[model samples]
Target chain A: MLRFIDARCMLGERCIIREGDPNTKEAILELMDRCHIEKAIVYHAMARESELPAGNMALIGETAGDDRFIRQWCALPSYFGEYMSAEDFFDAMKQHHVTSMRLLPKTCGYSLRPHSIGKLMDLAAQCHMPVFIDLGTELTTDESYDLCKMYPEVDLVFGNSGYRENRRLGPILEQCPNFYLGTGNYVAHCGIKLFCEYYGAERLIFDTGLPTGSATAAVSLIGYAEISDEEKALIAHGNIERLLGEVRL
Target chain B: MDFRELVYGQKPFEGVFVFDVHGHIGFEQGSQLGPNDGESMVHTMDRMGVDGICVSFSPGIRGAWKRGNDQTKDTCKRLPGRVFGYAVPNPFHAECDLTPYFEEDLGFRGVKIHGNIQGETPENDPRYAHAFELANRLKLPVLFHAWMPYEVDRAADVASRYPDLNVIIGHGGLTFARDRAVAACKRYDNVFCDTAISSAPDGSIEWLVDKVGVEKVLYGSDMSFFDCIHTLGKLALAKLSDTDKEKILGLNAKKIFDL
Candidate 1:
């Protein structure tokens, strides 16, 4: 059996949507078990609409004793010292053992363009860390393209990209090697096969957008794809694993 | 079972009997995509191990209701046991008669109403009353293309009016429509939601089962437009017990459509 790692999951109650269950660590672990995911990289759902430090702390507290989870900190712009300076932020990540980072520029009041987040992007690039941005929420395709160009050394993964965004994503894949796609809601027919054929499996990572998306659906896309087992392994866990291993923290 | 076996093995879904409640047949100019003919649909079904499908004609739903219905009947005739027809009635065209299609020999198992495509007719629109009445009279389940909460509410309204009619909210009311879709099922005994494109926010399937009981949820793959394997995999790998999985996979659909 191929070991699976979910690249995206949330760990707290979402403020806006009160429809589903609260995403506590126990709930996520049970979900991972249900979908046969071996490990997950999780951030707190509160980060999408709350203070970054508090949300990150909540995430740290929730997964303090759990090894199955890899903590991802929600980052904010360092304007007026709202978040820490780039250096301090990196140190905090090391201290907290956070392997990945996510940015909600729109909800958190910032922009992906260098003018707003340039220093942070530079720090991320220097540290060889992965930064995740969600499509339709934090950034648009063009904005993601600009960020990828600005920080070639920083690995940027775009999450929550559905079928409608594929046509727009093709140019980014062609232009930016540092740019990657999170396959949580990627529902295009034969999308995994086509993605691997065009951009290589290393640029695609497995993510379920869990607690808000289907892990099995994401897994089935890669598992049942016409790609080879080696490619499946890379997309399923190896690619994200390689990125996490390269994290300076 | 191994992941590979569950997905790509010879009998990919060996033990489960999958009955897809939402499917489309024949091509539509608007979508400009489909292997929508019967043979292509069956070919895909065989590949995915879909035991059966309750299908409507895409062109029929778009505009050519009668021609599309005739084409669906022919397709169902071509593949009797596998392809079950859903009669599409254009409420805008009152001349559109659905009576003959529901007859015993015609083999239509249900009715499909698209409010979005059919000029956004509310479910309570008097023009649709005839079709709903026919469905109630024939004991056929009605599948409504519900994309919003209001659409689901309209379905609940019509369902309440015709107590015997089984109303299925297609796509599980999709996107922002999920909460209301669940409420509709909880409110009406005859209302059920199909798991077609509802594979979002992780535990939604388990949540739905928990809220409304497994019996109120049915497995539907918006196939040809969407992948059957994707929806099937969602249900197959959900956290529900095997009994619940069995019901969502085929049992509920089998009981609802009498297939």
Candidate 2:
């Protein structure tokens, strides 16, 4: 069996579409089992639409018992003490055992500029935690590139961006070694194969964009990609495992 | 075969014939991404293990309808059996004539109508009715690019009017509109859905199959616009029985297109 560690998944109720199962821990796990995903790094779906503290706490509470799930919290600007300060957020992450973080700046109402997220980025860099930003959501590709440039030590993982953005992403990948791409929406023809060849497998991580996206499509994109097994395994689990292992929490 | 076996190049479905019902030839404006020509299309099909494809011309959807149809016909003629043509008719074009192409000599399998692409909406347009009428008269399936519920409903209304005209809702009405597409499929026997979008939100395909039998669904890559392997992978990884998978992958297309 090919074990997979899905780096992107959400847990909570989605307000827009009521077709699929509720984005609960049990439901996510059931989906994982059905899709043959062994482990997953999860965030709360509420984080995208709700306040950061409430959403993050719900995420921590809901995913308490499952060690298979690597907890991911939502990051927000520290303006007016709405969210934690840089040092405080880092401490909170350590205390809560949160290994990774995602940003929804647009939905959460914040900016990706240094003035807003610089402290968080610095702390994340110091602690070796990976911060995920979806292109066209929390940040555009250029903004993400700027963030990577500012904090070269922080590992920036881009997700939810489709294959068409590859031309835009090419320069970012070439310039920033600390950058990574989540393979949830990388559906370009020979995209995985080319990414593996050009950027090495370590820069790519397996993700399903589950609940919102297809776990089957995610698995198939990597599994059917004309790449070697070694590369596949690395993208499937090793890269994410290594990133999680480096988390000081 | 298991997912692992299929992904590992086992060719578990060696004998099964796969037909891509929705695909495109030619190029899109301002985007140079794809197997635009016949040679590249064949190369991509070979790589993805697709036995055949029913293709439309992109230029026809934009403008220059006749030239694009001629190009598609020529490509299909050059690669007989492997390549099939979908005559894309610009309903807005002053000289939109599809009669000759539907003849046996042309060997075009179906007609493609893009609602939003041609600077017009497909619902309640007189040209669309005429085109649908032409397709109904010729007893050919009409693939309609329906990205919303209203479009699917409109197509369904037309299909209801012309019971023999098989109208396929492309991309399964995309993400937000899939349920509506499924509803349309259930309501109308002549309505079918194709999976061609970039993403396959969880349980969407399964829901389609469960709501409307596997025979109402067809495998479509929307290739050149999208990757064939991606759609193939989506179908391959769907939690379906091999028999159902076979039907959705190609058997349904074969029956619809008579390939």
lDDT of each: 0.80, 0.79
Residues B1-259, model 2: lDDT tens digits: 4533574452434557889888888877754454467777677677666789889988877878889999999998898888898887676775788878876756588888787877766654677676777788877888888877777778788888988879999885455687788888889999899998887676677777887888899888887766677777767766678888888889888877877
**Winner by DockQ:** 2
lDDT of 1 at B153: 87
Q: lDDT tens digits, residues A107-134, model 2?
A: 8777777888888887887788999888
**In candidate 2 chain B, what residue range of length 10 has the lowest lDDT sum?**
B3-12
The worst-scoring run of ten residues by lDDT in candidate 1 chain B lies at B1-10
For model 2 chain A, give the 10-residue run with minimal summed lDDT: A16-25
lDDT of 1 by residue, A1-249 (tens): 666899888878676654554365676677677666999899987776666778888888888888998999888878776778877888888898988889888888777778877888888887789999898877788788988888888999999876656667888999999999988777654567668887899999899887777777777767766688899999989999999888775
Predicted complexes: DockQ each: 0.31, 0.44
True contacts kept of 1: 0.42
lDDT of 1 by residue, B170-216 (tens): 87544568889988898999999987783465567788888888899
Candidate 1 stretches greater than 4 Å from native: A16-22, B1-11, B25-44, B66-80, B99-107, B173-183, B186-189
List per-candidate RMSD values in Å.
3.3, 2.5
